[model samples]
Target: MERSSAHRTPGDPVAGMALPVYIVCGGTGGHLAPGIATAQRLIRAGISVELVVSEKEVDSRLLESYPDLNYRRVKGAPFRLSPKGLFLFVLHNTRSFISGFQYLRKNPPAMILAFGGFISVSYVIAAWLLKVPIVLHEANRVVGRSIRFLSGMADTVFLPDGVSLAGIEARRIRRLGMPLREEVKHVSKETIRREMDIPHHAKVLVVVGGSQGAKALNDWVEETHKSLASDGIWIILVTGPGKNQMPELKVLQSDMGVDVEIRTFAFHRSLHELFSCADVVLSRAGAGTVAELVCCLAPSILVPFPYAADDHQLANAQDLERRGGCIVIDQKNSSNLYREVLDLIFNDWLLGRMRQNLRRLNHGDAAENLTKQLIESYYPGHLRATAVENSTEAKEAVNG
Candidate 1:
């Protein structure tokens, strides 16, 4: 396969060619967030990126904040065995595959970086057929079905530390952590709390249910907020889109006549603020959410979405738990959630320890490292050689 013009230097003959890296990451925030993060890094390095996303509303909503990103929405459906489900899956995927193939044939990319999802299946196959190098990043502890299916065809598969896929060649796999967004870094707790008008001394509990709100977690907050508020815990609840109609802020009085505060939102664009301000977080254990928690050093009580495919959320939470970054509570035993939250929140020692562990787990350079690897894979030793040459030229020019 011919090398794409994307990696060429500006003075190269074909440098102005329009070939861009195509990132297939859609369906959920988990997939799309990392894709956007990596895309941002690539764009800063002078590599153009076009995101390939699904036709899901969530994808559109997520991309709304990223109007500058070039993206295409492809129709896709998850695989299902039922007759009707199977028919829709085949029909949608066939259309996606045809569209993807035609596009790639016309404007071949330097490479296709796919964050595993049903949306990626057709694109990966199309890229493979066109001999485009493919790279897969699996953020979860257990590999997803899409990555598992597409792994063999990929030039490289990036997995979290200590995680591996069964069938892929060991040489093809690399240990890299999740790529977090630029906005995911931590801010001072006091700074954010003051900005949000939260009390300085308030014990804050933040509940996040992922892109689509967790009804169980939402209900738990609804049932227990009053009691929690009575104990002087301020609540920041993200109820997902359209799941609740509560006003953004509410003030209540406890039996002891102490004023209590609760803030609720359908979705929050500034998650770093909430996570940084949180004393303890109650959240579903999606890999992206776990990575954000680690980035913010927010000690959390993770409730894995029991219905997650292949129980991947459980696996993700377990890995974090083993690393001492979090406490995992099975959704089935959520009755223990209130007690766990109370226990963790009041125990300053445990929370501090968990925060310390999370700091150790934070792979702050994951995006930069992944971007370097992706470029290196396409043009072996080219980046390093260019950097050395540039450095030498710069020094010579200065000395001369």
Candidate 2:
């Protein structure tokens, strides 16, 4: 019952192939983090991992620690905006498609595991033509546009839950919660408070609006900093990129004498610490952020971005709201910020209720679950033994 290299077709790929190559992903941290977690699992189980990435936008340093990972550039892009933008985007996308095809034709992977993003789209098309088995992941509350277009082509499309994909035509979808790095599963609140130098008696509120700052939210917080700071609240605001008005906020903080903290960060990996320090998380509802908050059981005041594709952020926030886990505030209604923050923070009963509901949605071991699914779907035969072991582990995890 051993799988032979001669018979290593799409039906059976990962058996008897010495050092079968697993493609680790690198798109955004949202897409790439899950792939990294899975790659670490695969490597421990003795498989070779090759990282497919765009040499641009992603920090190669992020993948530097995993030297075992093979880094290869797949022509990737930022897509188009106007008519001229359309022409340029098409030109770049075509070149990417051609390069991806050539790469696959020369050096093939045992299986292609795609974590959906603009960069990963080229690989999906290449995998289709190469006859490689594919395992795709959709982490958002709604399947992304790229996943929707390629879902029919994948051997299996893995979802965070049914809430994320109700009308997509993909039938091979399985509900496996969003996989996260080892860090998300742990970090005591006291440890986080000590690291951030937060006072034990005050309520700690962490404000983040995706990787790039939410300017609207930041503006509102800046204007109302004194009033909130006077109410025994502490702020840890992550004002992204050039959006940090430190000179301005500092002046306001000094004049008002409010306990306000301003942080301007371009990149940060140790998010578990910040999440743990938080009593309430104020942020735009991105799928990746939502999963991490759920892991920490952080009560969220979700302000979904008004312009995300298919309004996916709104969908993400609404799904959590339905579970009674987080309160959804409209980004369009930043006028209500003061009222929303006050009502949630001062209301002890409301805070505890949210804590209980958010804790109910925590999927503590998503990384292991996702890795097992990819292996089972892509690997076959004597490896069916390993796959069976993986399935049993997944079932036990679900129950526990």
Candidate 3:
């Protein structure tokens, strides 16, 4: 079925094109990581992928390693508390929506995957106006305001199992587990430790402060450094950018008499590697962090950020804790973190049980499952051969 260039549309960058999936995910690693993982899976199944992302510093740094995918930026701003800030935010959002509409009109994809951010809201609206089929994913147990508003227009809303959004008008809802990088499943612990210069014998407690730095979490760790050191735990603290004083922390580590290795980084692109080297993760319960901890089978002490939208981080932590995978410490009562750490370290059986529970929460094939669903439900006739091949590959993966 050879086609001439004359039939090629201006909207498409490539000629003689089949339908590509357009993914709108940006701002933070939580949205971007899953989007990239899913895009990688789709590409492997011979599907084209184009991403619409924000040019936020974190987004740019994260996307640098993924050069094969096609991505463009749409300017975005968060809603502000002040009236003047609100006006500017609205103005920026309006321009973003217009930009998204123009891009979609030019390079219309087969469908859109909205990964729940304010930036994604604009693109989702543009896709709706263009009559493009859309699948929305809300990573948290409690839906984000943007995704809740756009749910009515989404063809399908994908959520984690047992999560429910009350009074959503989506055409259909499905439980498609969180998508994660392939490296999370395959990276060796020894290799990760060697790369980080952490000793294999040292019990590692990796502190992740999410994509944006958590000042409270960092302060807590610094305050409790001596206690943590007394327990013979080496800490790999990933201190995200903004108000970072890693040099001071290093100096403090050198002064301490306790035998604890406290290595700090502003940010590390390879977080999966850090997770692999961890015996216990002391982290803020972002949805992405929870998914990764579960995927890596790491025991954790989750402290949900109180100010997160709708207190969704708390819900995320609660869900994992309910399954006996981790202990949740309320940020307001964060003094409990030290006690929880002692309990985890002393109770060998507890740590192992939690790790076992965490392992049960892993969904390594989430991206593949989502890809299969999209092919079967929306474009059944379009990629029959590729779909069959993917099906066989999935079976072989499970059997092997």
Candidate 4:
């Protein structure tokens, strides 16, 4: 891959003098978003970064917003034991390993910062072989397969509080929160409401089904939207790509003598706005989504994706619920979803408390703190001092 000057800021200390940090974050939005968030922080600190992502369409779509980010696409496939699954996994991973090795041999990175994903596996191994420092961040409470397999090779492993890997040394582990995109901020609800054309009096419910979308959640909305509409609720459903054949906005007169509006979209880019304006959100409890909800102070009813590896989503939801940030409903018991949403939406006191808890749970500077640690630990002498000073100033700015 050709080196691009686009990622370097005006005063980048090591703009053309040193190799850039390689961030292996792709496959799903959960992994990629946090990677981008950290990359942005590093760039602002005058550290160059190149993102390595999978060839998935979702990855491509999300990268559209970041036209200037230096990134490369690599083939990746999930690990499975079944015959065809294993065959494809080996085939794709081998290609990715070769691709990563060729590039890194020519232009070795200062370090490899990887968010757990299948796409990270190949590159992590290549970095390990090249003796490049590897830093792995696991957002979920239950560690992922990639992180678990690669943890021993990593110089440092970042994980959520109270979660631990059996054999990894305590010295190599750090308790760190998930990194959030800069766009995921707490904006004024009234301002967002006006921009989205939602009425001030409307009780807004936003449904998000992870990155590729949730079919079960979409079907639930389709089945019970009229009931919700009758209660004068405004619904914004993100149906995922190609999942919703008809995406339109509809305004209906509710039986309760109120105007109910429903908007359906295949995808929505401005999630921070959606979460900020929402009175309640129905979402899958992916670590990245949960982190965004906390940042936006959006109270939510979470349904963990039943098929998630090691049932990690359930672990994430449970942790949030333990902290009073959100409510968790098992997918098998989804028949209770409508009732739960209605009960929670109109409960102002409960919602307020949840928001407060979410605010307390919010670690707004995860990306900054993580970047600072990486700079202090892995960056070269002259560049490390400059980057550390810049990161400290940025942190002070945020706090000030």
Residue 328, candidate 4: how far off, in angstroms? 0.7
Task: Per model, state how many residue pairs clash.
Answer: 0, 1, 2, 0
Clashing pairs in model 1, backbone N/Cα/C closer than 3 A: none
Tens digit per residue, CA lDDT, model 1, 1-400: 2224443332333322255789999999899999999999888876789999998877888899899999999999999999999999999999999999999989888788999999899999998887777889999989999999998888789998888798777888999988987777899888998998888887899999997778888899889998898888889999988787566888987667878888898887767779999999999999889888988999999999998999999999998999999999988898998899999999999999999998888755788899988766564444666688899999999999
**What TM-score does each of the candidates earn?**
0.92, 0.84, 0.87, 0.92
> What are the candidates' C-alpha RMSDs?
3.7, 6.0, 6.2, 6.0
User: What is candidate 3's lDDT per residue for 1-400, written digit by digit as tens?
Assistant: 1122343332423421387889899988889988998898888867788988888988887888898889999888877779988897798899999999998899878788989987987898888887777789988988888888888777789988888877764347888778886665736678878886776776778888898878888898788876677677777788787646655344223233545677888888877778778888899898888888887778888889999999999999999999998899988888788888877866779888998887777665887888878766655554656668889999999999
What stretches of model 2 exceed 4 Å from their correct place?
Answer: 1-26, 55-69, 78-81, 163-171, 247-260, 380-400
Which candidate's lDDT is highest? 4
Per-residue alpha-carbon lDDT of model 4 for 205-255, expressed as tens digits? 999898889999999998989899998899999888878844488887788
How many Å off is the CA of 247 in candidate 1?
3.0
How high is the CA lDDT of each candidate model? Answer: 0.87, 0.71, 0.80, 0.88
- Residue 1 error, candidate 1, Å: 18
Clashing pairs in 4: none
